[model samples]
Target chain A: MTDLDLSALWVSVQLATTTVLVLLLVGTPLAWWLAHTRSPLRPAVEALVALPIVLPPTVLGFYILIALGPHGPFGQLMQLNLAFTFTGLVIASVFYSMPFVIQPLQGAFEATGTAPLEAAWSLRASQWDAFLTVISPIALRGYISAIVLGFAHTMGEFGVVLMVGGSIPGQTRVLSTTVFEHVEAMEYGQAHALSAVLLIFSFVVLLAVYILNRRFPIHAS
Target chain B: MSRLVAQFDVRYPTFHLHLDLDIPASGITVLFGPSGSGKTTLLRCLAGLERAPHGFMQFGETVWQDETTGRYLPLQTRPIGYVFQEPRLFPHYNVRSNLLYGYNRIRRDMRRIAIDQVVEILGIGPLLERRTHRLSGGEQQRVAIGRALLTSPSLLLLDEPLASLDIQRKQEILPFIHRLHHELAIPVIYVSHAISEILQLADRVVLLKDGSLVGVGTLNEMLTSLQFRGSFGSHRVGAVLDAKIIGHEPQYGLTQLDFSGQRLFVPLQPSAIGESVRVHVLSSDVSLVIGRSHSPTSVLNVLEATVQEIREISQSSVEVLLDIGAPLIAGITRKSLVTLGIKPGDSVFAHIKTVALNEEVTD
Candidate 1:
């Protein structure tokens, strides 16, 4: 493979890894609140989070580009430029992959119910203790699925990253954008090789999830 | 006497509960009621799991909740152990870790119950290393109880702990619960709708119906009270007599019990003489005879009783509450009542066809 291909692959790996880590840290509490809270705003917030799933990637990328530009609210307030940067790409990928990480975690938390937590409370576990000792272990499967889906979804981002990051080599360029560039350049051989790698990687990650999930059923009594 | 005083007035959309209770601080005090009768709600209130906005509860010196003073202790802070109907063991933890979950949380000096003793009492030694998902329903409950006991709480709340178990599983757990009553000094407030469990485990019963406290009394007092019987269904109508084993007739395979001044015979009991046993005699098993009939019969217990009151149960049947030193109820036909001229204050002979000895109870 060419150095550009290696650089694009490395950038893609870094972006996916960072995005998944950020989602896990940020999404856990958000997913937990969505699973438990009965507030009227819960549905509104959930719908908002799930918006990117149905909205076209280009639309999300366009809105994110506007929000992070020097003229937009964030750039105006913070006096920082993020558009056409690696950070902008990461932020866009996180938004595009939001539902993929959150929905599974929310389902897992809801399925656990409050019975075990109440049981833990009666046994002298504080709320925090119960979450650590009881809840986290039970919701481990959700974390696994969230990480796999979130990382895979971020790796496959093309339209959103291209719109925000503009295919800058070794900085903003990633495998999906490079694949597009190769196909546009009529280099079918490079395009085919990159597509095959992505296909195998995605298949292996999904297969591992299904097999592990079946082996350790989440709802075992 | 050490006692728990609880006053709760809760208003929910579907139900309203208002109760005042003074429960003895030791032995098993059963909260008996039908479904949606607020038994479990009362338990939750006592455990501080359900906050009653205008409630007050004090167990001995501990003030769990007093809304007037704006003092309320959350569940984890209260010295209580609760066993829910479902054995809510941590599915991720093995039996040993589940038991230790509470045991390790308390300060070492405040740990009143030894882990080994709890394991022995619940008979969960063999299942300690097993995963919670692998346990049978009965075994899971036993481990739950053991886990609760190891916490060394001042009070234990058990909300229909046996409700989810089958008859055989209930039988498996009942002995362990019985042993817990005898072995521990902690006050247990057991909530159940089952009559047999009340008859077997209750030293005192707090009867509730439709969010109201109907009565609170000893097992014998409640069982014999017509008001209690009326609240319970007709099938559960019975009398509980405290009788002492006086002698054993090995040849006849019978044990003689002395109740008040009357001698009653029962199937051979494992307990020695002088041990008191609670005998549950269903009102339907009692047949009344005027002026002591001198005829050969299969009945073993024939006692002279004074009719305290007679209440018509149905068009055909009447319930006669008799004072045989202790209260004993007999369900007789209205025709027989009229034929024999049985009325209030009339002396009669109560021929008990069967007296089911409640062998599960031990004081």
Candidate 2:
């Protein structure tokens, strides 16, 4: 692999890892709320969270680009120009891969139901303690699925990263964007190498998810 | 004796539950009612699992919930143990870890019941290493009860712990629950619509009907009262007599139960001599005789008693409340009442046809 290809691969790995971590830290509470809440605005919030799943990547990328640009809502709040940077790529990947992380988690939490949690509470476990000890362990399969799918989906990000990150070499270029550049330049050999890497990586991640699911089923049945 | 005073009024779109109760803190207080009767809802309110808008609950001196004063203690902080209808054991943990989940969380000084004691009492020692999902229904319920007991709670709430089990499994777990009440000083509030459970476990009975408190009294009072008989339903209308197995007549396959100074013979039971038992005599199973007779007959129990009250039960039937060392009800035809000219304060002989020995109730 060329130096630029290796750098892009490293950048992709870094972005996927960072995005998965960020999603777990923030998305857990959001998914939990979505799973159990009965608020009237639940549908609206759920629709908004699920927008990236159905909307075209360019559409989501366009909005994210405008939102993070100078003088935009998020840009003014942060007081920085994030467009065309690696951080910008991360933000776009997070948006692109959110449903992948939240949906599975929300399903798992819903499957867990409130009985075990109430039992835990009756046993003197605090709400936080019960979630960590009871709810999380029971939802282990969902967490595994969420992590794998989120990572793989982020690794394959192209269109959103392109619009927001602009494929700046060493700073914002990733494996998918680099492969696009290779194919555009008629470098099929390098393109094949990178594409094969992505194909094998995604397959392995999905396979791991299935195996884990079988080993630790959601319930005894 | 401290009491648990609770007043809660919960309302939903189609159902409403309004009750104010004073339950004795010790002994097994059975919340008895039919489905959709709000018995479970009342239990939930006491546990703080369901929030009533203007509820007040106090256990002894500790205030659990008081909407008037705005002091409410949540379930986790209430110092209470709850065993749900389902085992509700954590699928991720083994039986040992599930039992210790609450034990490990409470303060060191608050740990009154040791793990070994709970395991021994519930007979869950062999199940400690096994996963919860692998346990039998009866064993799982035993483990669940053990887990709650390990918390050393001030009050234990059992919401039909045996409701999901088969009859054999319920029979298997009843003795363990009976033992918990005897060995542990912790108060228990048990909820069940099963009359057999009430006969076997309840020291006090609180009857609910359509989200309202029907009545609360000792098991004997509630069982014999005409007001609460409707709540118990017709088939369950009977008298519960506290008795002890005095002797066994193996020749005839009969066991003799002594209620006070009176002796009642029943089919041979597994319980040993001197063991206390509850004899349930259904009202429909008793017949009235004008005088005591010594003739041999199919009815093994013939006790002389004075009629305390005669209440009309149905169009053709009248329930004759008899005092034969204990309160016993006899459902006889109104024609016989007129034929024999039976009335309150008249001495009569009660011919009991069938008697059920609640062997699981023995302490």
Candidate 3:
């Protein structure tokens, strides 16, 4: 602990955890809406969910900073500046990792199948009950996969966090940006240790998710 | 009052279907038709799975839909039970969970059906612990029925529930449905293309063809009508005659049944006398005679019959349909018809022997 520099490693885990939690809460309804609604505006809603996947992380981070700056709409309304703050790192991570959490959930919901849902509906269950009791449990594995991908993607983020966080000490500096600062200072040993830890941590998390997902038993009723 | 009424028309690329329906308040009313007759579309409409352009379905005070009133009840809100061709049991649930999925979700104030009785009636009690995928085709179907019945629906819709099963498997699950009809007052709108299913299960039959309604009647009328005769052909065409068992011979395993003051001998091997039995007489096995034949042969039912019409059945045989106070049909070779000169209004004897009449289960 004394030899290894972990100041930015702790910040990265915090940013990844908070961003995954927020995306899960927000992406659930968004993915469900995309899968269910058939209105003419469905295409527009789908485009909004997909925009993050195609846009470069730096470009997305720039727009997000403008939106959360002191004079920007949400920031001005909240009477606070979020850009280059700890809060800015979370907001940027959420925008960059939105697609990873939502797309898999949408596919899983689609594959959960319609027969069991319809059967539950015919059994006099309300729509909410049918989804909770029938549809959600069937897609539990999908949710686990979504959370893992979102967390892992946020952990590895570089451009978005760098553009928004601006490398504040003990505040917004994450593991990826911390390595950049160490490289610029010609401190190769500290940079190598942090980068290697990030790599191994991400690989373990993703491997554990996939192996656990494969081993979970799905009981056919 | 008509508890269920739906009139809708849908256009498809290959076929056009126009459906107008009014079913009874109780018992099974089978929607019978061949493959391309839009039977499933009608059921899906009733289930609210398909949207109808100009459709209306009402179950008592609850109005399911009326395009004029700008009201449509989705499948979740409607008090309807549906059993599809394949058993769509929740793959993640055990039998008990699937069985109670609807039962526990709905308000207890609306509960009218006894869950235990439904489990017992379908004979799925022992199977309640097993997973759905482990069950046989017959067991899966029974669970599907129980799942629907536990909903306590006003009307049940069955779309060819037994079409996927083989003969013996269908035979196994059919008795449970018959018991359900007797035990519960909910009217079932059954759909099937097999006439034997219509005979054994349906109290009323609504026949369809080419996406149009052809005939609607009881078992006797549908079996006797000329329109249905064309659908069933000469082979599976048979009459389900309700007769009182007069006597039974424990030795030769024969039973005598009386219908309209006429005695007929069948291999019922009835266990109890005075029990009601159903006898089927095929049109092909019946041989007609002009006068009283002196030959003492195996022709058990050589009763007097009047030739009503000489309908050309096939290239080689002409069906001599008879009405000897009871509807009877006989298919004879064209040579026999030409030699005997049998025409309409001629008296004859319909020799019916060695015919297959299965033992039917009736309440």
Candidate 4:
């Protein structure tokens, strides 16, 4: 596939891995708060988290690009170049992949029920400990599915990656953009090879998730 | 030295749970109530799972909650071992790790109960290697108990730990819990709706009915009292007796028990010599006679008992509760009472059938 397309593939992997890790850190607590909090602001917070999923990916990327752009509030406040860079790609991927992980995480949190949490609380496990030890472990199957789906979804992104980061070799160029470049250059054979490789990667990840999840905490059913 | 007092008012979406209770700091305290009667709510409040802005909970030296102060200790920080109705073991860890998850968190030199002892006490040795899902309902609960105990909780909160099991399974798990109550120094708050469970397992029972406190006392005091029957089904209605198993008569298929200087013959049970045993001499099983029956019938158990009180149970039946010193009640037909002139304070011999006796009790 054109000498393994090392730079594009490396950048894509870096972006996907970074995005998943950051989302896991940010989304774990967010999903937990969404699942548990009884505050009146919950619905609004949930809708805001889900906005990236409901709105077109290009729109989300555009807003994020503007917000993180040099003249915008975030960049002006932080004094950092966050648009059309590796960091920007990661940010855009995190937004695009959030609902993928958070939705499944919320489902898992809900499935854990109130009994165990209460049990852990009374057993002297702190809220953090209870969530980490009891709720997280029990809902681990859903969490794994979320991780795989989120990583795969970010890897396959086109519009968000394109908007936040147009083709910039080594710096921002990813597999999705590389394929677009191949198609534009009329390199159908290379495009076909790369597409086949991406299909295999997605299939393996999804299958591993399904098979492992079947034997996960809640059991086969 | 101080007692635990909990008085709480809870407002829910549909129902209100109002309870006033005092649980001492020793023995297994059972919250005996029917479903949706605020038994669990009371437990949660005691455990700090729910904070009603105005509820009051006092435990020994510490004040857990006082609505005016807005003082509350969250459940995780509270030193309480809790077992929910379900096993609720972590799926990621095998039985051993799941147990250690709590144990590892306890501060050094703060370990009151040893790991080996907990594993031995709950008999969770074989389960340590197996995945949580691979374990049976009873096994999972045993591990759950082990996990909770390892935490060295100040109070153990068990919300119907035996409810999920079948009759046979429940029977198997009860003795382990009985040992927990009798052996452990830590107090327990057990919530259950099963009258049979309360009879088998509780030292102190706080009875709840529709979110209101009804009765609180020893099981014996609760069982014979008129208030206790509303919790136990009418068919299951009977008196409980605390008796000392004097010895066994194998040839006669009877076991002899002594209570308040009265020697009573009961059916045989698996018991050690000089050990005490509780017997549920169902009121319905007793046929009272004014004079000691010298009839040579196959009725194996006959004891000289004095009637303490009598309550009308049904049209044809009268519940004659006896003070065999340790206390026993007999459900007899009104015809037997009137025709035989069975009255309170009347000394009589109670004829009990052999097969009616069950062996699973603690006196």
Query: Of 2 and 4, which scores higher on DockQ?
Result: 2
Please report, in order, the local distance difference test score of every candidate based on alpha carbons: 0.89, 0.89, 0.80, 0.80
Q: For residue A138, give model 1's deviation from the true position in Å.
A: 1.6
Ranking by DockQ: 3, 2, 1, 4
lDDT for each residue of candidate 4 in B251-350, tens digit (9 for 90 to 100):
9777888877767787776877677666676766777767765667677667788888888877987888877665667777888778877677789878
Clashing residue pairs, backbone N/CA/C < 3 A, model 2: none
How much is B177 displaced in model 1, in angstroms? 1.6
Per-residue lDDT tens digits for candidate 1, residues B1-363, read 888999999998999999999887888899998899999999999999899998999999888899999999999989998999999998888999999999989989989999889988888899989899989999999999988888898998999999988887886787678778777878889998887787778888999989989999988788777667665456768877878899999899999999998999999988899877778888999989888667787888999999999988899999899999888888999999899898899999999988887534221
Residue B99, candidate 2: Cα error in Å is 1.5
lDDT of 3 at B42: 81
How far is B132's C-alpha from truth in model 2 (Å)?
Answer: 2.1
Q: Which is better, 1 or 3, measured by DockQ?
A: 3
Worst 10 residues of 2 chain B by lDDT: B354-363
Candidate 1 lDDT tens digits, A121-219 = 998899999999999889889889899999999999988997889899999999999999999999999989888988998999899999998897644
Instruction: Record all residue pairs in model 3 with backbone atoms less than 3 Å apart, i.e. clashing.
Output: A220-B91, A221-B91, A221-B132
Chain A superposition TM-score per model: 0.95, 0.95, 0.90, 0.93
Clashes of 1: 0
Off by over 4 Å in 1: B242-251, B255-264, B269-277, B284-327, B330-353, B358-363
Candidate 4 lDDT at B220 equals 73
lDDT of 3 by residue, A31-67 (tens): 8877777789988877887788888888988888888
Task: Give the per-residue lDDT digits (tens) of candidate 2, residues B142-239.
Answer: 99999999899999999999888888888888878888877888889999988788888888999888999989999978888877776666677888
TM-score against native, each model: 0.88, 0.92, 0.83, 0.87
